[model samples]
Target: MSKTYDVIVVGARVAGSSLAYWLAREGYEVLLVDRGTFPSDTLSTNNLYSNSLGLLRGMGVLDALLNTNTPIYRRAHINFDGAVIDGLFPESDGITGCLCVRRKYLDQILFENAKAQPGVTAIEGFRVTALIQEDGIITCIEGKRKDGGDDIETYSARLVVGADGRLSKVREWAGSERKIAVPTDFASYAAYVTDFVQEGEMHVEFYKNQDKLAIVFPTSDDQFVVGVMYPLDDSAWMERFKSDPEEGIRRLIDEGFGHTSLADRFRKANFAETVKGMHGYDNDWFVGMGQGWALLGDALSFKDPAVGQGLHDALYGAHMLSEILSQYPASEWKRSWEPMGKVYQSAMEAKLMSRFWIGCQFTKNTPAPPEITAAYSLVGSDRQATETFLGMYNYVKEPEDLQKEIGRLLSGVNPQIPQK
Candidate 1:
């Protein structure tokens, strides 16, 4: 008889591993499979804002992550054009700062924790080749070892999940159609630097001149991850970078930030690893839930990476699914869980839609509106205003709230009510 499980999760990265961990904690039999092994590096922004950190803490992996010596960034310095806005992260839900741990280390921690769980079985280096369906419902999956040495394995499950990411085979197999899709015109390149002067805070530097953006994130082991996003129309420059990544990144930094401390650090640093990058980050969302199967993380939806929400959304979405599944028995998953899964998918897409709109504004080759420019000035000088603006990124405040605040500041209307 083929082995059966309560749930079979495809792609054991952030989404699969996190879901497995939570489900196993609830005493569900979970089989988590991944084509890639643990401790493998993938393309990512890799920074966790305060909200994501809160979720990690709730998952019981925060302490282990902290032990990795990932630098805690308490403040952010954002430079748009010549306008500078500095903001301190507000304390919330016991999280006081952000982290910039590499995915290689962080994903390994999550995968290992899931593997050690009592009811979770993790298999790496196996690719799911087919979904077994009976009477229009998924019943099991067929997987083959990448090495071609082991026999094909078949596993039955009450439910199957695809956490496989943007290019998801499970999504294809299930015939999930894209509901909304947008093409991207930008590419990103990033590298890790060591022996660079550590900044006391995270730096988000933007060059409005040519729609270039760079982020300097201090990560574990006294290293920094410097990333740059630029227009894909400049293919020659991108190709030059691919030919000589280190020099390409160095030149971009120097031209963008000049002789500032951030650029100086880049100039003096040594490459800790080879630069890696990706192109065409188009946002995509598909019909996520169906009978006996569901999609999680990038497999369901993805937004542009410019907002740095990929990892956070994946982890948080997995947590949300696990919470919903815990309320129902595996036998009734199709009937009881599918509706809730649809609700979750809608909510996830809604959140990403907001961020994607904001990202579009930044990517355009035009000056920011005067109101936004004025808001930046206020944010640079006022702590409350800075928090309010930065708070939008953490979902503490909405984009509309920022607009209202900017309007109030521009109108010279004091937020304080007049004393009667």
Candidate 2:
């Protein structure tokens, strides 16, 4: 006899763990499964903005996360060409700063929190092998031990969620079609370094030469995450980095920053971890709802990671799904879940589309437009403008509104209209 649950959430990382935690807290019988064990690392941006930090606090894991000794960054410095924009993170909604904890630590906190919930059952090292359907609606999930054990299990559920990732098996089985897909022409490489000082601020330094983008941010245990991105077409550069990542990063810092003291610091620092990265990640948004099934996190929508918004979107999307599911009883999921899921997905897309467009601009090899550069300069000088710009990431202001404000500012600075 198969054990039944009100909800079975696949992929127990940020999205799946959060969904399970919230749903189980609402008194539902939730079963969460993942192929990987807890405290395992995954390739991620690992940067958390104000919105994501607030979600972690809401989940009651903020104190534990703080105990992990992760650094809190209160400022951001973005440098493009020779123009530098320094901005203080607008402290609002009770969040004072941002964090950059590794996924191994952060996801484990979320997973353990979910498992501690009374109505949740969590299974690690188990992979979902198949979906069992009746009358064209998914009702049960089949799983096998990832370690090649003989134990196979089936569990029925009223609702199943694909909180996996971009390459989600659940999404494939659901036949969800991607509605928006855009491929980026860049690849990223990242590694951890110890004693790489940034003076308690996060820096996104871009250099026009080699079309390179570098992010230097502090994380837990006096360590920093240094990452670089370059054009995918530059195969020689990619091969060089693939062969010797540390030396490649050293060369990037020295070349991109023009041999500044920061570059010297990175060159002298000890690399705490091996470099890891991926290429050909496309921005995708799939159909999010189906009968007896729904998707969350990267499974539902994924954008270029340059903006570091994926984890934030995942946590908040799970929060929103829990809110929607709470309104209907488990028995009525078949009658009510899909319609609510559609409404939630539409709202999520609307909120994220503007930021998505902004992130796409960073994937290009060329420098930003003059008006955009003007905006960054304004952020460096004007405190109000800085807040307005950073507010886009915090969801306090819409991207369209911010663009209009920037345009107005630019018009005042450059009064003459150039005839095209």
Candidate 3:
């Protein structure tokens, strides 16, 4: 049990697996563990834009993702009520040219990629029970096979990571907390459907009505990810979803997306499986690392999936951690925890908080004033502004950062602007 490694990552999905793969590529030994078998599905929006795709390509997993035959999407078409705006993406061949792929395929792809690396070992169907602490510093992990075997298993590492999830056992064992918690402003549910009509090239579609927002994304396996985000200031819809998930979301789609062409698309289609929903959950974050442990993915932070940045934050955090871990030799990591933790906090905060705020704004789902809609109309008309608008969601540019530019653009068109 005393044999330590560069890191032992629990929860071998996107965050954990991507972390291990990135670390292994840097010549560090990693043990990646998860409680499920390959291709198992999880609750996710499962969309990643180009910047996140860059991380996957750097990790050498994009080639396999391409083989899944996920549709290639080059543009996004946003329907604000009746007005439509089309924006081209700023060139990315990553993500196999798709906006989303099912976690059934995407998580397994990242998992297998980590497992195949020379410095990485993997354990599936394993449940971690506890972290072994020595003098208040985590030094090892203890768990048993998810099967009925009674023998305890132990894994030692210089760093024990809690990529497990929002309900991470590692976070609990490490005594981490939701250092920052905020009430999320919206509830969301999404489902996959077959027979979704895609004509010619694929497009990421967004439909915004009075106070509701819904999306259609092209994922792998001949399915479309159709989802709706509802204002959570009122709890009625959340209660409805709790009462009956499928019916609640189905109703939302029938009402919200019905007027659009999406109605005809879903006319012949049926849900691929049960509806998945996220409701009444706080948008939260925990300390990035502790004495001898760290957190990643939803374990460390989760923004509103309304913004669809969950997958992006996972890979982005993991990549950031791997780069930080490389600053010191693997053997010295235990002693280097103090300085490492400092740098980790500073860097991740700068990167995470901007998007965190963006998610908050998006979840609020506040009505766009005429000026804002006018701005949207401008983006619709200009190619460059359209790219900037798209990049705001994808984190290429912070959404807030675009306010000045958008105001400048609007000043030229709207008479409400005073000539200064």
| Best-fitting candidate, scored by lDDT | 2
User: Cα deviation of 73 in candidate 3 (Å)?
Assistant: 0.5
Q: What are the TM-scores, per candidate, against the unseen true structure?
A: 0.92, 0.92, 0.90
Cα lDDT, model 3, residue 192: 88
Candidate 3 structure, TM-score to reference = 0.90
Q: Write the per-residue lDDT of candidate 1 for residues 1-420, one digit (tens) a residue.
A: 279999999999888999999989888999999999878988777888889899888888998999997878877777776677776867766787888888888999999999999999899998899999988889899988788665789999988999999899999998887886776666778888888774654544334434677877778888888788777888777887878978888888888778356677678899999899876566777887787788988888777766777788888788778877777766677676567666767777676668767765654546577766666777677666778878877777778887777776776777676634
* lDDT for residue 18 in candidate 3, whole number 0-100: 95
Instruction: Please write out the lDDT profile of model 3 over residues 193-264, one tens digit for every residue.
Output: 888786557888888886778888888888888888887765777777788876776677678778887666
> In candidate 1, how many Å is residue 240 off?
1.4
| Prediction 3 global C-alpha lDDT | 0.80
**Candidate 2 Cα deviation (angstroms), residue 371:** 3.5
lDDT of each: 0.80, 0.81, 0.80
Q: After superposition, how far is residue 127 of candidate 1 from its true place, in Å?
A: 1.5
TM-score of 2: 0.92
Residues 247-307 of candidate 2 have per-residue lDDT tens digits of 8778877877763456766767889987898876888888887877889999998887778
